[model samples]
Target: MVLSFLALSACSRDFLDITPDGRTTLEEIFQDEKRTEAYLNRVYGSMPSYFWKYGFFDFLAPFSDEAYAYSGAALGWAAGMLTPTINPLHTPQERGKGVYHWGTFWAGIRDANVFLANVETANIPSPTNRERFRGEARLLRAFYFWELIKEYGPMPIVTEPFANDYDYTTLTRPTFEECVNFIASECDIVIGNSNLPMRITTEAERGRFTRAVAYAIKSQALLYNASPLWNPGNDKGRWTRAAEAAKQGVDALTAQGYALVGDYSNYFLSKTDISSAPGDRETIYEVHEPQIDPVFSIINSIPSKPGMFKVGATPTQELVDSYEMQATGEPVILGYQDEEHTQPIYNPASGYDPANPYVGRDPRFYATVWYNGAAYDNIGGEIHLMETYVGGADQLLVAPLGWAFTRTGYYLRKFIDPKLQSGQPEDTRWKKYRLAELYLNLAEAENEANGPTGLAYSAINTVRSRVHMPDLPQNLTQEQFRQRVRNERRVELAFEEQRFWDVRRWKILDQTDKLVTGMEITKEADHSFSYKRFVTEYRALWADKNLLMPIPLTDASIIPDFDLHQNPGY
Candidate 1:
């Protein structure tokens, strides 16, 4: 993998560094359709390869409602990290930037560009294959832009393959508008194409691109633009474009066979079971792999109760508390009885449960966060354990370790099947886009366009209904409705790799805390240290200029032009 990455990076130093060295010219490469499809397959795989490390700072990993984080782990690191929740920092795991994995994205982008340049002339025998190639390129291109917009803001929008003499190295970044408009327009073309599937008809063709993926991507981009975090630099047009694009994507995907999976949790669990149903009527778009083929895979997220990355919860506690209780339809915070605990108040009048932490919580929490006592059913049977890190020096104070981070206080169980352990690593693919996100996106777009329209309410209600949460107050405003949708997105999309970007675009980092400084009691009322029973408290832990990295201070010192022009606070 390291050699493969290095070889790819040797092609281009810009954006992602994964450019594989192929002696064939662009024209020569695309002449054969099979090669073209194989190249595009790598493009989809790149999303996961990039996303795996991306869980740290790729603008999607840390965007939860709980807390924010900081580190050079990624370019958009500051904006997404450092929110209100789990505030862990200065660990050995903080190299940031999802830096090394970027080679895969850039390499894949290079392939897309090289393949796209020759796509017009491809003599592929089937007309369907031809259109599919075009759609794949368009979708992958959109996917690349997804990274660009989140990381570099409005990066130079590159569509056509560039020449060696294009003088690409000296250019400054593109205007955010220019970049966004280009992405939005391309999605329009991709979404308009009719050759893709909303639901696959064959076993081998499961993870390919579809019209729904296009629409889902467009909605995501549009929502980012519409967000106040990116907007209010007078971005009305961006918001309108986002609304329109999302509407188009939604209308088109919904028209072609997308619907909701009745039990949102079942999608992940059932796929690992052969007896499980094959379709989620609600899935507008998704990326899947059943057998872990190298072409396109998501095995990184499929570890056991104790995973490889003994890292603790990547999810901030703030995100954990955002899910509304099914009965009350309100924020659910798991409080600590300790005086050091910072969870507002735990009284019924304060609106939360102190003893029954997991009861009546956000459905996604149970679905995503494997609490200390959460029981998960896998391929063979049930495994009762906590999703935390209880290894290393201070393992005494922590929970058990898992593949990624140790389950900080809670392990991420969302995409992982309760029945599928790392032992079996069940074939349930690390799913990308499903129907729930589409509904959330629609609610968001509608709320942005007209606040609390019936459309927005219905969209949000559909999602809440699945988990048994009641409808919102009838008189909510647009902003209020938008907040509801935003909160919904936070809980629903937790750990699925959308949080980081969501928080960045929402620009809520500065307004929230970025650490999980909860207090756990070691001493009881009798002044005896509680052995297995300790009290844990929650609060912001640190305040540092490090919130925004110094542009890889070392990189800036070497590159004169970058200078001390740091991001806002760093």
Candidate 2:
């Protein structure tokens, strides 16, 4: 995500031989306004992968602040303490937390800033078209800055863009609150004035930010502030704004034609399911990777260890337990079993007596996770990620290996597009935000702000109803309603990488530490009891404060004046 490792010329001569009309100007790159607009489009491509790839905010969403945790080797902490899931101050994993005083994010800001500055003076024709282009740049700039804000708290505003010298490291950061205000204010301007569509109508418009995208981001920022981790609404000053922003984000998308698709899997599994794609009715905004670019490959995050499911970032057992069930439209923490004495079967309909083990169970059990020894139509038809070799040796990835930790108890299946072979070149893009999430967000935020009344309850039911989950019981306490909202989010939105962020927003990383389990495996001989006792604890790791990546020590040293004070424990 940092600018490519290759260093290119800061001058345009590298691209064009000479200027026509004897106009040797830097602005020539954006000549005639049309070029300027193209410049804006190009910035999206130029976006650094840092944030998603070990960058500052990358771990923040997945690590801890408040909500839940599963003990896997967490991201960033040295002692492995500061997981991308918990208090991260005391871990060696402190990635360039302070590195921002000068890293990928700042470099990105500099580039985005330059493009935005030049865009301002371009002679674009239609004011509306010009406005849209400018708006995109501003959003990208804001996005870069927001990335900084999420981790470092605040930073110096480099609005002029980074066209200057490497010595630019001298500037100090702004106060956390100031940085928050700047991003929020700018978001409003972009949403208010830009001609961005509520839904993208073309592939070309895929990565552009629309009014709803702006709201979704703004709400996310506000929600962070409202949470205890950031002390956002320390004395209740911003909680209203948090709720208001989340509400606005959802309302804006819906007003512009966003609707929840009837099935949960469609959002991630179907490309023809444009209902959630850019310009598609369900996405408010999304980070679109060009299908042609390797970055667009969904496999990077979905495949196992090195690739196929890198790091096994499945829902913690706690999250799996969070999923609601079929027979009962409630949280099935313990799930359905064989008459409480027979045995526990995840797929009763399959009826392979355990004598056969597959029997009655929660519908989500099979859909959201890959169970130990479960069979599915893989490349050759029936293949299981847990098959054992006939003799004594590690089982193939398709088989149960000899001493495996159960691969965290549950395997994520949501983002796995069947067409994407293990290492094939699949270029379907990764969605950063979709309308389905906005609905769930609205439900959660409203529940938090108003305690499960009117809009809050209705919003939640709309989402749950998608999979036929019944309306939550009436007269439930706020705690009970809120619990439903949380679990609903886990089941309905399992692997699009939302769990990592949700834990942060609510400041409950510790709460999430308790393993949420599901889809257990068992053996058969007497045709009576069970097989294996598996849990997603496969990825569990202790918590620490270094969870917040360390500001890059190099950046801090270079910008001696840039003493951005690293996060506490790191």
Candidate 3:
């Protein structure tokens, strides 16, 4: 067999970093239980990192209209992604903008296959231990497959490691249904294994794959399978299936005492530990970073005046407008009488004040966005107002047209720890899947299966109640309810890498990605603020072809018959 191995690094203290003097044999690895376990730990490291500072901070928000890339080089990927210029070979990876894990994930899949194929031979004393290890490998493999399908659509499923003489030319992409089935089957195998615990008990194995993780992945995959992109016939049966799967996952987690933790604003901040405390109950699965400072993520989003780089992704006015009025739970409807945006009209019922645009909005708006005159308590214990208006501090006009600053008169407040100091270590646990997302998934699936049922309302209301938002209207048509679910998901899951995929799956990308707008704030002579909503001139060109990312040109070139397998319009 042509076996490949990842060189284990000593950077992480949780996993063992075993270095062989030379090329190590499978016999040497499998004969020792610790070595076999180390191999699995390496696969765990491949889980995606949302905090890594590269191409627009690897945030999916900028690709959508949720935010805009202010930094020059970072803008390259965002700009390319929004236009037809984005080709397979010149993706975010080539531009040094974001972490494209298409290749990296495939390698992890190969490692998982190798471990599963040879794990039984390892010197594991207990049969239970062997089963748990095997189950963990299956879960990791399913996760990698889920990541692949989400990015590149249908993929060739390789369960066993290929032989040295295996032919690469014979490979062909599976049907989308087959890919989904393969992932579902892997999830079933992990869930059915009795040896796998519902949750990891040991602190040392805090982030290991568990039964809850398996169920969460299954729920997500099934939900995607029922989306418009995968279900072309608008199959009601697919929606029913998705609802059942999501409900099953949510019920299992809740039965295990999982629930929302803390307020909405504090849920994503750094936690002291991952123990099963009230504060940590919301996280289903997370990419845990231990005892390390999230400086890269924090510094990228912090204002330049706060003793750090100010260039980062800024929220757009379109996203700002999505936040509903706190008093009336209805979106503020704003209209411009002229192109200059000097004259503004607001929906009388929306209760939006042009003179004071940021007041009486959804509490999440204050928690997630840093707008003009928003106060922040600095690490040095000084409260400062974020002056994003023209000629004021953090101004867009002062910087040259391309310089890094707030282009939309707003900065991200979520996931940024106010207590962070220079050179101080801050640990952040990036929740990959949470209980709240499952609830949203269930609400969407139920509405599609059985339009605007009590089940759907209850599911969505659970999320709204967490932030103390009022419940959705009691009665509405199915279509109106659908819009409510979508808008709710957008507001609740903003900047957590959900909006980008949600828009695509919902098949509303063209409508949502049309034009990103910015709030042009000006300070009046009386120290009052004047807000003008103008198009940021950054428009995303979305077509049916953009539903699926193109297979990388490098991968296609090496294939014997690329034309048959390449995604349409690539």
Candidate 4:
């Protein structure tokens, strides 16, 4: 009997011991192509669930100034994340939890390593299939490592399964550059592989790794490596390399016939179902969950009215002000006059009417944010007007009833399918990488390398043209253009979990995450609404050490030399 049990459960700290079972041994598993494919699938299944579940917070927007949490206290991770109390011992669920299989991503890495080592020996009939499987395993390994680096900054890069007798404590983290090089090389392997198709055609293989996915990963990794957080020296060579890599990924995606599809708002609504015809062409990589009713995702972000799910995440006023006026394509508020932050310096060209605050704004703002008096379609095609003003239906002043309402006088409108009804089953995919992001990435990198070149403007304009927004103004200096690109990224990728990381990578967390503000709406007898912008008592704590998450305390405790190996200020 070849006992098949070398795989470690996700939570096991006894790294080398795999539970013994009566299943077939590694040899028998590899001999059968179907079993080997199943093993690879298991590795792919370890990818983190991007949606909210498993004690994880799905919307990272709250961590930034984009939003605030109404019911985040229900989840320990979410609650800890919003406060300054977060520590190495109680990091987000991305770090390992108590013994049971909860937050350990290393098990997935080990599985990928095992697959890479043995797949070459498997007796697969088709050489192309075998090579493709190998390519996928390599890409997965890179992805797992990327996840680690994204959180802990630098960590050990294990390429092979360890033996029981091997001393695990001897393992130490490599330099940041080494880890980057390792991940980049693995991506290159997948991209250069001939057996892997550029795009998977069979419906069953839709979510599998492909050449385009590899390029996307490569572009993201290069962009991170070139960021200010990682590149302290401000190397122009690094920025140039990142720009070239992003351009290559963009060019490859274009060659594969990828383009922005549908209206910006409609693209998200149409993605409610993968089976929806004329599938999203903008998606380069996405996490597809067909059986999941993604409508549950909006339960907390929506109004807490009758027949509605619970309200949780609420949009913040700071984010609302980021949107530009549609008429002038400029920010509604240019800047504040005083430190009290109550006075606003409105842009004369913006045509912003305080009486009708939400009108004449960027189309995307309407698509993304639900403000006072906004009409929302409920479960049965009934239109409900949001009354966020005082004593109104969704006002924050109604004691316990108002507890569920938005603190900022606005709710999330993006990603909620308006067509979805109560008790209806719907599915949504989180686009891990899309053409728009690549365009933004290319624009940022090009501006950094060559300083406001035509390539930079062209890349940014491509994204703007999709929403019918005007192109960036001409004759701006490099610094001015850089700020414009940064703002563009914030508005374009709001609530998509980009701002949380982007702020950190640019080392601007102090300015962006320091204070949060919300709008208080009052209704007069005439029924018109008056607004007061107040800085909320809630504030986000930021320090130099916050740029990278501390390594989990448990992992540090087990290591022989914790002091030298641990991330600083842990």
Candidate 5:
């Protein structure tokens, strides 16, 4: 009989461990230094690589208003068809049935527990290495819990592994605040460990956890704790905690010589292989996956051409309108006049013309989205422009009428390496946490804690200046600053999986997720284009119940006696 107490790490990359032959017992595995290192790598593997094929192909973009995936789980999610069994956010193990297996995050946590319990017995000679290993395990454990909390809210805080004879039916989840505090404490333990470096500077140690990562985790948790969905009472203390933690996180990172990248557009295309040179210091933590055939970019790069696959994720006009006009540095659209998003509340002073919408937009807009009439490439010294107008090469096609064309009249260009051609293997690694997020976190928390102070203005302006966008007006009120910060996050972190949680945490999904919009362009008689905003998709009903995902039914069924305490409205 195969008696598996914990699932071993399956990731066999250079950093992760490949279980050697003839290692049958836990005693034997931990007795050797090489085996011990391999075990720790298994803990690292527990982190679901969003860059890897399983998570990347169907990312969280479609689950939120950032973009719409024409097929797969995101499409169903957009239509409000989500349930306990059909949740795209939960059960991300794309390779298997949507079971919330302990083998994924729970398995990682279990492995970390095993490592922490047995690392002292390992055959390591270096004291520093042992402490660092312990720190890494603790940090990974904290991170796994954070992931669970973000998706499903409160969860059972199982720090140590359960015994074979342990009663599974007695498991109970802690309160949301308790879970947040527990994660913060775990991160604090790791942050206090000096053995672990602040930055993983070597290429070989590129994806390893560091103090900065722990800090990022803490900041994220605190910010979520203070958000409206969780802190419905408008708890000032929660805001204060979030503000202090974010500020501390920023200070700790900057002290370690980290800052935003010089160029905003080029940051996504920067190297993931950590070089000793001071290049792209913004990425505090990143994840990398081995390159595979028919790279991810092929799906997101462009619509179906002779060699290209259909654009899997298409940008929505709702997202495009978030960009401020460069000429006036003001938002083009204030809000939608209707829930369907067909009628937009245009800000007239911003000089935004519906017919000439593409011009004079935010610089980051050009980097993130491919719209009609925009210059895409220089082929043989001739500028190649995108023709998204009717009958054009990249024409819009409604669902059920087309497969590989843009449903929303735009293609995602945020992470696409413009330098790489079709079929070329591109770098698939993405920054999990970066300096810009930290700055934004600080700005948000500070604004909540102390109104719109100069510090808050400076924190957000730093991010704006990177893209050459004008700083927000100095005299705006607290609510005005708050809106600016949220928009800044939406555009700056577009397609980065931030908006999905932002809408939930801020409790604005009902307003933002009701429907996504798209622009339809038609070539007029004079060869000019006329633009019209149309509803791309109407999302399912987002309510207070949607503030948290339901615990997977499979897991709940396995322990029938246990309450499982499903989130309401599931």
Candidate 6:
């Protein structure tokens, strides 16, 4: 098999760097212990970065109702610009954009396969290292497959490295069931055969895949297969399998000392360099970026100062409305009276006063959104409240539009430090899989499989209790419980790239993606802010056809027979 690899960067740590020349043959590299480890690290680097600086620091958030991407940076899907020929996320790297695509996925898988095929040739002394390295490669290969299955539905499963003369035209896509099963089986192999530890105890191996991560992959894959988009029949068997997988995952993670941290807000900001950090134990797998990067603080956050980049992403009022009231555990906005969502049908018992909209809601709301008059930080050792009202310090930009401001009348607070200065580094880690998600996954799967069971309630409550939010009512029907579980998942997992796929998998994108609303704050002469809801943008182009991403036309043309059928409505 012929294999190609990128020349490893010299700035990378000793174990990850290879020679500058890309001509280093695989056979020659795998013969040395350090080179073999470097090859494995290269495979690890192929994992998707949902919060990279490349995609304007917001990958999937802007596509969903959670947030709005400013300046068309990551709003192609929302603007109806996504096509087989043109996808912002799948654009070529030469354009300095592409986040995930066929080329990256396939190349990553090929590298993993090459590493697996040649790892034994290396002169590594430790048996534990050899076992862990093999397990990591297997899990990463499955991860790439899982990503492909999510974006483009079914895909051809290539286990081994392809030959130079391999017939690309002969390849055919597998069934969705087969695709899901393949990912689950690969993760299973890593769990059962490999000696990979359940959790990584050392800070040095923070991002490495563990047995908890494998379980997370398996649980998530099964849950997606059981979702409405894939399992249209509401297959009880599929949900049962998914529930079981998620339960196993949760149990394994808990046994390995994984649990939710006490402080919800600070957990996200905990530094990964310390093994004893508050949230470190809960993170199963995470994507690491430069902690000091401006993308986290300046780009995707409120404009605290001048000459900063235009606000990249701003939280939507729809996301703000999803956070339940703490007093009654009721949704603030029951439903909208019109398509524009200006008239919210408020629940009388929830105590959600439109005049003072930011009071007495879920504690998570304060952590996730920076609304009008919210205390931002102690700038210059004095408390500075965010002024998003009309003509306020952080007011919404209207004319002369390129100013750094919020289009949605709200700034992102999740994963952003309020105190991070312009030159300061923020501890922003894009958590891919965490213990909380495992519980949510189990809750959703259990509720679907067996209506509103104790297991489902327990799983969901675990996440809610972490944020000190009230438990969901026990008398709810299966559908009601499902909604609560979804809401819990939404508020807890906001801005983590889950909402984009969650809406699609639940087959509710047609309802949720059409329009996103924003809070229009106007400060009165008395300095009291009056809030009005208005439509930020109309996404008429987002329809049922957008449920699945299209296989890029460029990739399809490479196959001589063109047998790789495009997704429906592409």
> All candidates' TM-scores?
0.74, 0.74, 0.89, 0.88, 0.91, 0.91
Off by over 4 Å in 4: 1-23, 54-58, 72-103, 270-278, 291-309, 337-341, 397-403, 423-425, 561-564
Worst 10 residues of 2 by lDDT: 1-10
Per residue, candidate 4 scores C-alpha lDDT tens digits across 1-570 of 111212213322222223345354677767876567667776775666553332333365666677766443323332335222344123344322221222446777888888888988997777888888889889988887887787668777889988868787788767777788888888998999988877655555666778888888877888888889989998888788788888998898887777887689867653422332435667877765442334444443343332244455567787888888877777788777865456879988778997888988888888888788887777357787888887777775424444556666777777765556642225556677788988999999999999999999999989888888888888878898888888888888888778878888899877766666778899988978788987753553466677777655566666675543567755
Q: 318 in model 1: Cα distance from truth in Å? A: 2.5
| Global local distance difference test of model 6 | 0.76
Please give, for residues 387-503, the per-residue lDDT of candidate 3 as tens digits.
Answer: 888886667543445545677778777776555543223566567888899999999999999998999999998998888778888877888888888878888888878887888
Candidate 4 colliding pairs: 300-312
Q: What is the lDDT of residue 174 in candidate 2?
A: 65
**lDDT for position 384 in model 3:** 71
Per-residue CA lDDT of model 6 for 278-380, tens digit only, reads 3457778776544444454533333233225666677888999999998888888778888778888988878788889998889999988888878867445
Between candidates 2 and 6, the lDDT winner = 6
**Worst 10-residue stretch by lDDT in candidate 3?**
1-10
Candidate 2: residue 179 lDDT (0-100) = 75
RMSD of candidate 5 to the true fold? Answer: 4.3
| lDDT tens digits by residue: candidate 5, 271-305 | 55466556778888886444344444434333222
After superposing candidate 5, which stretches have Cα over 4 Å from the reference?
1-23, 51-56, 89-103, 294-307, 378-382, 423-425, 558-563
Model 5 whole-model lDDT (C-alpha atoms)? 0.76
User: Each candidate: what lDDT?
Assistant: 0.53, 0.52, 0.72, 0.70, 0.76, 0.76
